[model samples]
Target: MKPSPTFEERWKRLTSRARMSIPDDFPELPPAFHTRVLAHWQAQPVESWEDLLATLGGRAVWAVVAVCAIAAGFVFTDFHEARISRPELEHVITLEAWIP
Candidate 1:
């Protein structure tokens, strides 16, 4: 029985046969080459940090929303006093735990 071809041998044969017998505008590429060509075609210029920051800064509503959200989180979730209660005679746990 014959051994199956290795990936490199199969790819070379596939690509060699797949090339334009009669050249048309488009031909299918090998899987490896497809990603590179697609990436090149899809590439765009990236925004700078300052440009990003400026865009974020322009939205006054987000700044207000962020501040209010932070304020609400601080106000609502914090325990003003310990929920647990124990006898004072046992040298009971003081409110010092609540200070921080």
Candidate 2:
């Protein structure tokens, strides 16, 4: 196998391939190019939560919120029913009746 090149040899090989000189007489950009770029940047609409909701429409947002509230209501009612019908409470009541 061939040995790896030294650091100096590697650096020189890299630099020789990248050697480029800029010419003294580069042409200037047109004045309108700057103003056009600035105007394009300024004309861009900044988006926020309100803009996002507006794009989705008020009715769609309300529908999603209503669906979530319904799901939450179902979950809460089931949890409450489970808590009320616990077997441990019935067992405790039966034990108290036997003791008394």
Candidate 3:
């Protein structure tokens, strides 16, 4: 069986395979094409926040707002414990007493 190649040998082989040479005859974009693209971009109107919200629609916006409000309510509201009955408290106390 042949011995495995050293790290330096493997690295040199990988780098030699990965090396790329640019072709001499590279294609170039015409000046007129660049001007036409720039003019097309300039002709398009800039959209505002109102335009974006309008695109989303009223119902979608309200649903998002409602979801955020519900999330906030859950995060901010204090959770209160329900009152335990005497028998329930006694049962817990008995279980705790047995642990000792």
TM-scores of all candidate predictions against the true structure: 0.32, 0.33, 0.37
Give candidate 2's whole-model lDDT.
0.86
Stretches of model 3 off by over 4 angstroms after superposition:
1-12, 17-20, 24-26, 45-65, 68-100
Q: By descending lDDT, how would the candidates be arranged?
A: 2, 3, 1
Per-residue lDDT tens digits of candidate 1, residues 1-41?
99999999999998898884757868667798988877876
The per-model lDDT (C-alpha) reads 0.77, 0.86, 0.85
Query: Could you tell me the TM-score of candidate 3?
Result: 0.37
Better of 2 and 3 by lDDT: 2
- Give stretches of model 2 more than 4 Å off: 1-12, 19-28, 57-100
Mind giving the per-residue lDDT tens digits that candidate 3 earns over 36-79? 99998899968888998798888898999999999888766634
lDDT at residue 66 of model 2 (Cα atoms): 100
